[model samples]
Target: MSDSRVNLGKQHPAAYKALIALSAEVEEAAVTAGLDPLLVELLRMRTSQINGCAFCLRMHTRDALKKGENPDRIAVLPAWEETGCFSETDRAALRLTEAVTRVPDGHVPDTEYDAAAAVLTADQISAVAWPATVMNAFNRVAITSPYPVGG
Candidate 1:
């Protein structure tokens, strides 16, 4: 399909605004919780990838790169479990991000939660969760709305 076919900006202004506002709130929470901006973007990209949210994947991949994330790491994110590109903290955050993003599978298994909790402080978890929740919400919105992908 042409890029204009998936252009969310032209298709639903009100819905887009609401999603933007929600994203802003989540970003504020992430900042307050001391989550690394790059990490947050990475998590968003990963979650978006899992949900097939092309718009988000495109947007966040650019954002992550602009924020100094290593392109090689981003390229290998989907295979993070098998790669050594991520740090311990990044691994924890990614695990939590996946769990929260795909909660219907089991609401984040104890092992995953424990591993993330062991590396991140309470505040960090809160911050990370907020972004993950917000991204998931937006993912649904984009998916259900059938939001346009480009242009």
Candidate 2:
């Protein structure tokens, strides 16, 4: 089969625009919920990583770096649980992001939800979830469209 694929964002501009609007809203919500901007980027990156969305991973990774996220933290993001680079809130957000990204694995388990609840307020938890949700949708679009990840 040919590698050619329709760019979903361009193929249906209205739907893509709606998604973009939702992303902007999510960003505002994240900020209003008192989530650190760096943490928001990390959540986006982690969700992209889990979905194997190279297009998104590259974008969010660059965003994270531009926000002054430590390179070491980004490097060890996949193994976040094993590192001391993240704070309690960061860990909670990461765990929730993973659970949200891997929903088909078994859905978000009680352990994950409870863990997040233990450290994050209701607003914070919702903030983490919305980014993960938006990232997952964007990942599906980019992956299905086979968005090019140029060097």
Which number leads on TM-score?
Answer: 2
Candidate 1: regions farther than 4 A off: 1-16
lDDT of 1 by residue, 29-147 (tens): 77887777888999899999989999778889999999999999999999998999988888988999999888889788999889899999898887888788888877876676545
The residue-level lDDT of candidate 1 at 144 comes to 60
Give per-model TM-scores: 0.84, 0.96
Q: How many residue pairs in model 2 have overlapping backbones? A: 0
Model 2: which residue pairs collide? none
Query: Roughly what TM-score does model 1 have, to 2 decimal places?
Result: 0.84
Whole-model Cα lDDT of every candidate shown, in order = 0.84, 0.94
| lDDT (10s digit) by residue, model 2, range 1-151 | 1378888899999999999999999999999999999999999999988898999999999998988999999999999999999999999999999999899999999999999999999999999999999999999999989578898
Q: Where is model 2 more than 4 Å wrong at Cα?
A: none
Following a full C-alpha superposition, what root-mean-square deviation does model 2 have from the true structure?
1.1
